[model samples]
Target chain A: MQKTWNNKAWFLVLPVLLLVAFSAVIPLMTVVNYSVQDTFGNNEFFWNGTDWFTEILHSDRFWDALVRNLSFSVIILAIEIPLGIVIALNMPKKGVGVSVCLVLMALPLLIPWNVVGTIWQVFGRVDIGLLGHTLEALGINYNYTQDPFAAWITVIVMDVWHWTSLVVLLCYAGLVSIPDAYYQAAKIDGASRWSVFRYIQLPKMKRVLLIAVLLRFMDSFMIYTEPFVVTGGGPGNSTTFLSIDLVKMAVGQFDLGPAAAMSIIYFLIILLLSWVFYTVMTQSDAEA
Target chain B: MARIDLDHIRHAYGAKPTRESDYALKEVHHSWNDGGAYALLGPSGCGKTTLLNIISGLLHPSEGRILFNGKDVTNLSTQERNIAQVFQFPVIYDTMTVYDNLAFPLRNRHVPEAEVNRRVNEILDMTGLSDMARRRARGLTADQKQKISLGRGLVRNDVNAILFDEPLTVIDPHMKWVLRSQLKRLHRQFGFTMVYVTHDQTEALTFADKVVVMYDGQIVQIGTPAELFERPSHTFVGYFIGSPGMNFMEARVDGTSATVGSQSIALAYAPAVGGAQKIELGIRPEFVRLQREGLPVRIGKVEDIGRQRIVRAEFEGKPLAVVVPEGMDIPADPRVQFDTSAINIYADSWRVGSEG
Candidate 1:
């Protein structure tokens, strides 16, 4: 069948094309502009092809911040997936309890990221804050401002509280969409409770689980504001993740070329990793 | 291999039932014989599924005990009751292969692997899923998935009965015939006590030895397919069992004879019971004969359905449908005669006497 070659279809796609240009393409062109070009003074620019990229690629500070970012994302994903699914499974399925659980789960998510950072910053003060004071009272050395381990734990815990609800909501949506027939059929089939979850619930929740993972990966990978306010790259850069380091280079030290190069690299890493996750998950979903 | 006795069972979905209208399933005291093929035939929301669930122990009756071969199982869970069920929509483990779907019940019961393999293979062949057994069940079409559901039901030998709740609804019409025949063949081969629920009269009549007709929330009549057709015990059964359904006309009855408007018709039997609030003359289209000289009828329309032509007409001011043989001549003055041996007199919805 020959489809008449009408150029009108591209006209229909013009809005979406313009949207992508504004939000993604135009900004990326600016990053590319800065990445290979150097600006010394007002309106003075010079072509310095790949020099900043090479400097950023070789710098110890860049490598350290990247390692921190990678570890944080991995740890966040590992803790959130299982924990969210467990909470979703245990939440009440019907009546007033469902609304109560949903509202409670959504409460942490509704708070602004900066506000979360401020709340945590004050809440972790060893002199007056409840958590820090309690830890000190318990004869434990706990301080996010001064201790690397404590800072990491505090950041991870805060992230889980802020974002685990998104996963819980996604998984819960998956769970309720399953018709009552499957459970009844399993009961008649003499399936154990664990078998029911393994065979029926998990299989049904696969698609939603993919979305949850991807969303969490993208959000956690690009995380900045909360940790920036809470630790301010903290107690001699122990918790200085990639975003904080990029801000320091760009805004703090005004190293425009290196910061721009590093930001482009960071964007590419997120895109590549997200694409990999989507391809692997959807491929397995298609197979099953 | 068990006789299921629903001993005075009643169910109400509300917290505290106050009246009969509140009940999902009204008091049902009935039993299904071992190895018998039965159909719970009714329109939608007629409590057929509720009854099936009760028998399977997915639901417990509010009023009475249920017994399987005289062993009380009303309080037991569906797993403890040891029955098999096929749902309206196919419910197979999507992540598993077709073979694994069939073997699931057996594996859950911890049956030996060799025995499970043999039974699964046999069911695969029986359901015509042998070639697709290695394929994942998630990718099968609706009818194919339903066949896996049937196979799972058949894999368990220890199950007391297999209950089907309109399992062929999602199947295409052509596949529906094939799957239904396969089901009938299975019932004959293994003689597993099977109770099928369906709103389609053709499916119920063709699939079961006995058809239990239900209306609202109560069973109107329970009889063999032949009995249901020839002598429906209730007006609802008479109206529901036939292809075009039984034609009912307002009438007055008095001992073997019934008067419909101005014309008198002889009944198959005399009613020993007293007169009731309503009396109706019931006769299937098969029993209403079109003739040259009888009570005059105004011919309306004729629908040719392959071998038979159903003539829609008006007899004595009431609408009527009489099926005639194809190529039969329509008389100039068309009139009709009701077969005396087939005429039924119903009083207050119940057929007073059908023995004659």
Candidate 2:
């Protein structure tokens, strides 16, 4: 029997397309308009073609922030992936303990982003917070607000605590899916624990780890909430990342043309990096 | 090739088993000769896989020792045991090429590069995967992936014993047959001590020289294929080993005669019944002869299975199956005669000694 072709499915997606166009496209067009033109009060506007883009492309602030974002993403990925895998390996595979461990790891992830920042802000205080108080009692001058190194450390640690669970979860799923037979086979082959992890567990976790890296990179690069709340891009702007600076330019100084151009450039950078990650990781699978 | 001795081995997953009933594997003690192919045959939840794991050093027996070539290995890990295993489903590195997968174990042991390549190629050729060696294992069909798993197990000749845990369960029917025959050939050529585990009777019967039939976590019988078929030590063996299983009829033994219901049939041997416990007569469908003149039976239905016919009927109100040769006319009046010497008597679900 010949099947009837249904065109009604397109109708289901029309609303989503309209919603995206209204919410995303119109704002993007407004940004594009701002990017190419300068506006004063009373709706007076002057055409400024490619000037803001050229200025952003040549700015040291933009370059420094881009470098900072790249480095942070790389460092976070380097620390999180291996740490996640190790923790996942040590986790109980079944029974009551599994649920407890899962809940514990998931606790940090469930907290709101703003709450996470607030909690860290208080917790890292030199006088009131437990961590800072303990470090002071130990005679260490640990103040995140005043020290660039402290700010960087706190940000990295916070990112690790909040996001490492994602990697652990993905790795755990990969680990659990492995049949007992592979371990048996590994045992029969007299494989060392390291070899088993390297050959079997690591390879099996490739696809999940790829996802973890991409997600962590994207989030770390675009991080604005926690660090902004904690540092306020302060202490001589030492902790000022791209998002903080973007907000500073767009909202603090109200530099519309330059900020819009900067925002577009930032979006393009993230898009390009995410696309690279996806392409490189999936290329081998596609080729095979 | 090495002789493996299991000395009073027992295992439990948790704490010490307080009773014989508490153990998953209840005191298995057997020694398999070098180069002899054996199969651990049992249904799921019967602890066959547990026993295999213990033998492979994946699990330590709570009681007794495992000896490989008269040396104790009870404290060894699976790696130290030098045993290879193939699992039920394929356990291959999906991202690696088939060649790399087969070569991984060899490289781990620091085998020379040229030698690794030579042996890998030989194994790939043997497994009929030479054409797909360079291809990644992820895209291969299930059967092909399983073949890679099998090849990984068989690649290293230095291992003491190769254990298979229902490895062919996921394989296609035709591939199962081909792989079984190929494995049999590999075992013969290399003289490896191979122990295959499967719940399927056909695979167990066809692949191994000796079949160890287990039930409820105990090894009920270990014998050659013929011995298991012709003379089963336990009622479970008789029931589990054959298709259509062994026909059992509740019986009462008196001197040289056995009575089924109200009909008394003469027995070749007399079994002593000490108590009012139940007694049964066990016979295969193949041995129960259908005739025109004998004990009357109510015919139920006939199943024509190509070369033979299975006459499903009731004898003396007890279900009985009789295998009749094809092309033989079904008599309007159907009767069955038990081959006297082929009869087995059981007491309380166990075979009893009866003088023949």
Number of the top-ranking candidate, with TM-score as the measure: 1
Clashing pairs in 1: none
Please give the TM-score that candidate 1 achieves against the real structure.
0.97
As a whole number from 0 to 100, the lDDT of residue A91 in candidate 1 is: 90
Model 1, range A1-288, lDDT digits (tens) per residue?
986998988999999999999999999999899999999889899999999989989999989988998899999999999999999999988889999999999999999999999988888889998998999999999999999999999899999989999999999999999999999999989999999999999998999999999999999888899889989988789889989999999999998889999999998898899999999999999988
Chain A (alone) TM-scores for all candidate structures: 0.95, 0.94
Model 2, B198-255: lDDT tens per residue?
9999999999999999999889999988888877778899899887788999998998
Q: Candidate 2 lDDT, tens digit per residue, A125-178?
A: 998999888988999988999988888888889989999998999899999988
Docking class of 1: high
Error of 2 at B41 (Å): 1.9
- What TM-score, to 2 decimal places, does chain A of model 2 have? 0.94
Pairs of residues at least 3 apart in sequence or in different chains that clash in candidate 2: A190-B79
TM-score of every model? 0.97, 0.93
Query: Model 1: per-residue lDDT, tens digit, B1-356?
Result: 79999889999988899999999998899999999999999999989999999999888787888999999999999988899999999999999999998999999999999999999999998888999989999878988999888888889987899999999999998888988898898888888899999999989989999999999889889998999998899988988888899999989877777888889887667864465888888889998889997788999999999999999999888999999998898888998998888887777888876434
